[model samples]
Target: MWAMVTLDGLTVTYRDRPTLHGVSGSFAPGSLTAVVGPNGAGKSTLLKSILSLLPIAQGSLQVHTPRSRIAYLPQQSAIDRSFPITVHDCVLLGAWQAAGALGGLSNAVLDEADAALHTVGLCGFAQRPISALSAGQFQRVLFARLLLQDADLILLDEPFNAIDSKTTAELLALVADWHARQRTVIAVLHDHSQVHQHFPQTLLLARGVVAWGDTAEVLTPQHLGQARLLGESWDDHLHAA
Candidate 1:
């Protein structure tokens, strides 16, 4: 498989504090991989840095795919549901890349949006307000949006955090579908069981990479223990410019 994203000695800082330090790895094209570690392990920071959402203090970060071809699903907590938008509109937003800034959606795009909603089991919720839906339902809506994106690379951060088991299963199926389509998928996950079950590759981090490679090998007890210790010992006083 080809490398879709590569990071070499990548370092990211927040408020003069290093969130990711000398992190190096590559995400293979068409592969399903998970980023897992203890709290403050820089899991989310890695994703953001890949998307160029954070300032890279040093080192190199390269993405083979174009920015327009990338789709991102941030953690639910980062979204504000109070925005006055219906589910249909929210899903339609995914078509923005194709529709362009002032381009209007034709009947075909509308049809695709409807189909995406149905695929995610949100057919009747198209006209429903985003603020009115439960956490699980909103997640489904986001999935529908991603469906319309047809992106080459998908990045998900804590996708199944608070959802029910059924929802998690349903969402995992969509992830499988993406993998089957040969699209690259990288997700930040906390559940070791889920990572072991679905993701073939894993990258363990603690402000820096503890291990990276096959999920089973990288997630060993020793590696996990070292990651936890590194995360716990991270000094907030270390300043990086």
Candidate 2:
């Protein structure tokens, strides 16, 4: 498989404290991979670094694809649901790249947005404010936006977190569709069972990479235990020491 993303001794720090410590790996093109680890293991930090949203403190990270060809869905907490934007408008934002600064939305784009909303099971929610929707509904809206993005590389940070099982299944199916279309997808997930079932590759991290390979080999019990230990041993007060 071709490599879409590569990290060489990549490190990221926040306020002079390291969150990810020298992680090295590559994500295969058109592959579906799951990033799993205990909380505080820097899973989200890794994603942000890949998207170039966070400054890299050390080492190098490269994406073979262009920046505009990547799409990201951050953890729900990162989103402001209170923003007074309609569901339709929210999804339409995906077209900004294609529409450009002075370009207006053509009927084709509007129709596509409507169809995307329907695909996510939010047909009549077009005019509704985002705040009026539940966590699941908002997630669906985000997915609709992703659909409009039509990107080559998709990064999802805990996409299934706090959502209902039905919603999870729907979103998982959408992920499957992306895989079928040969899009590279890397998702940060906590559900071991779900990851095992859907993701063919797995990267187990603990501030550093514990394993990176086939899902079965990477998700071994020994690696999981080590990841837990690594997360537990993190010292937030180290700076004060």
Candidate 3:
């Protein structure tokens, strides 16, 4: 059984500066893992490295899953809702690998898109402009797109940030469904209680890995404290230099 993702001494850089340093870990296929850390801990950077959206400055990062079979939902703040795209078109973009640009969507693909919208409980939102959506509703639209992709490996960056409780619960159910169906799900999250309640595995990082393994074992107070200290020390060093 091959791992879904593996990183060996992985160091990633952005804008000519290193963001993640010598981090190494592998996520087992079909596991649901939460990545937690304090601000500036490289949580999102890890996901970006997996998606090949950033440069690996040192060591190796591998995704055993094919590129096309991978799906990513970046932080909502990264999205430009001002773009003039409708909800239906935005969700359909998930099938881009299957339905090429300018290639018409097959009936089956169309059905899947519609079903994905329904799954996200945005039944009548297909025609709505994304600019008009609330933050929670926009997040739902992103999840609907992921559903359409049917990805084998899913990476979500801060999936539930700034959303209402009801919306969070609904999206979390979708994540659980993906796990039950044997999809590999790695999410960057900050809510410790949510991570404890829903995720079975945890990766606590601060520029480097503090701990990674069973959720209970890795998120202990000592490990959490170490991560905090590491983050603060890194900040202090940056300031000193």
lDDT of 1 by residue, 1-241 (tens): 6599999999998887888999887998999999998888889998898798988999999999899999999999999999999999999999999999999999999999999999988878989999999999999999999999999999999999999999999999999999999999999999999999999999998888999999999999999999988865664333431
Model 1 segments more than 4 A misplaced = 235-241
Better of 1 and 2 by lDDT: 2
Candidate 1 RMSD computed on C-alpha atoms after optimal superposition onto the true structure: 2.3
Error of 1 at 136 (Å): 0.1
Instruction: Write one digit per residue (lDDT tens) for candidate 2, span 158-198.
Output: 99999999999999999999999999999999999999899
True lDDT of residue 153, candidate 3: 98
Q: Model 2: what TM-score?
A: 0.96
How many residue pairs clash in all the candidates, one count each?
0, 0, 0
Q: Give the per-residue lDDT of model 3 (tens digit) for 174-212.
A: 999999999999999999999999999999998889999
lDDT of 3 at 145: 95
lDDT-best of 1 and 3: 3
